[model samples]
Target: MTLEQARAALAAARRVAVLTGAGVSAESGIPTFRNAQTGHWARFRPEDLASPEAYRRDPKMVWEWYAGRYRNVTHAQPNEGHHLLAWLERDKGDGFFLATQNVDGLHARAGSERLVELHGNLSTARCEACGTVAPLPEPNTFTPPPTCPVCGARMRPNIVWFGEFLPELALEAATRAFEKADVALIVGTSGQVYPAAGLALETRRAGGVVIEVNPDETELTPYMSYSVRDVASRGLAALMGEG
Candidate 1:
């Protein structure tokens, strides 16, 4: 469909739900986790660094890798896609929700209040001993990463690892959001991951419009009601009647 048609669909959508991925943050120059390893980390695979087992075996190494990522996230600004979605959420009030797979906290930084971070936020750390979550200390604030103040247990990045399931509450909220949405904006995702990919299918089955924004065709391309072949920021801008 044309840009006009997509815009019209968005304009008519009262309960809009958006699903974003790493591509949105890529617009802000933040490297996706799979591509972030560099310099001394060039030899280690992502799976080797992001798993719970990895953290258990070498907490210092894993923490160092995520510290580098946190620095990048702290410096990265939200792009056009993030701003426009925040605007849409504000305009729709309680009728809007954003469910994102990214752990960078960019959506929260973008001023999206009604958002669910499915993968958890990388900027926060959870106490492995007590499960209390807290913001990671600023760079240079700690020597070997901060331990939990309450229990003195090591703090791990509050991110879902390979073996961990998505946070139950966030997943439930996302599911409910899709159920109530009149339009589903699937942006920047490859549509290959399960559960998240199922959201798009759920929207389609529920008779909601599925608008996909990506630079290339994805696994869900065939199911999209309106597919815009552009990068997340540009495509979302055009859909919102900007670019």
Candidate 2:
């Protein structure tokens, strides 16, 4: 569909749900977990550093890796796509809900209030033992594994690690949004990831329209009512009539 058509659809929809992925943050210079700079340990697959077993076997390594990620994310600013989503949320009043698999916290930074961070966030730390949550200390000087001040338990980045479940509350919210939305805008995702990818199907099953924006055709393209081959920043701005 043309940009005008997409905008019209968005404007007419009563309830809209958005699902975003790493590509949405890439425009802001955030390196995805799979594409870290060469020669850095982060260049290794995220699965190697993001798992309960990994933290249990070598807590220091896990903490250092997450610290590096937190530093990188902190240095990056939210891109235009993030602002567009936030603007849509504000302008749409109660009709918009955003669910993202990225842990960068860019959505919140961009002022999107009704958002679910499905993968948790790197800006917070959680106690593995007591389930206590707190903002991670600034500068993250702890070597290797960090200790939680409240419970003296090992503090892990609040993100969902490999083999771990997504936060139940966030998942439930996302599911409800998908089930009730009249339009579902999927941006910047490969549509191969579980749960997040399933949202499009849920929307479709609920008789909602699916609009997908990606640089390439993802697995969900066949299921989309509208498909735009563009980055989220460009596509979403166009859809919101700001382009």
Q: What clash pairs does model 1 have?
A: none
Indicate which candidate wins on TM-score. 1
TM-score of each: 0.96, 0.93
Q: Which ranges in model 2 have alpha carbons more than 4 Å from their true place?
A: 42-45, 140-144
Residue 149: error of model 2 in Å? 4.6
Expressed as tens digits, the lDDT of each residue in 1-243 for candidate 1 is 677888998999999999999889899998877688778888998788989999989999888888888878888899988998998998899999999999899899989999998888878999989999989878657455678978999888888988889989988889988877899999999988757588988888999899999999999999989999999988988888655
- The numbered model that scores best in lDDT is 1
Candidate 2, 5-105: lDDT as tens digits = 77788889989999999989999998888776346683566677888888788877777788888888888999999999998898777889999999999
How far does residue 39 in candidate 2 sit from its true spot (Å)?
Answer: 1.9
Looking at candidate 2, the ten consecutive residues that score lowest on lDDT are 137-146
Instruction: Pick out the ten consecutive residues of candidate 1 with the lowest summed lDDT.
Output: 137-146
* Residue 51 C-alpha lDDT in model 1: 93
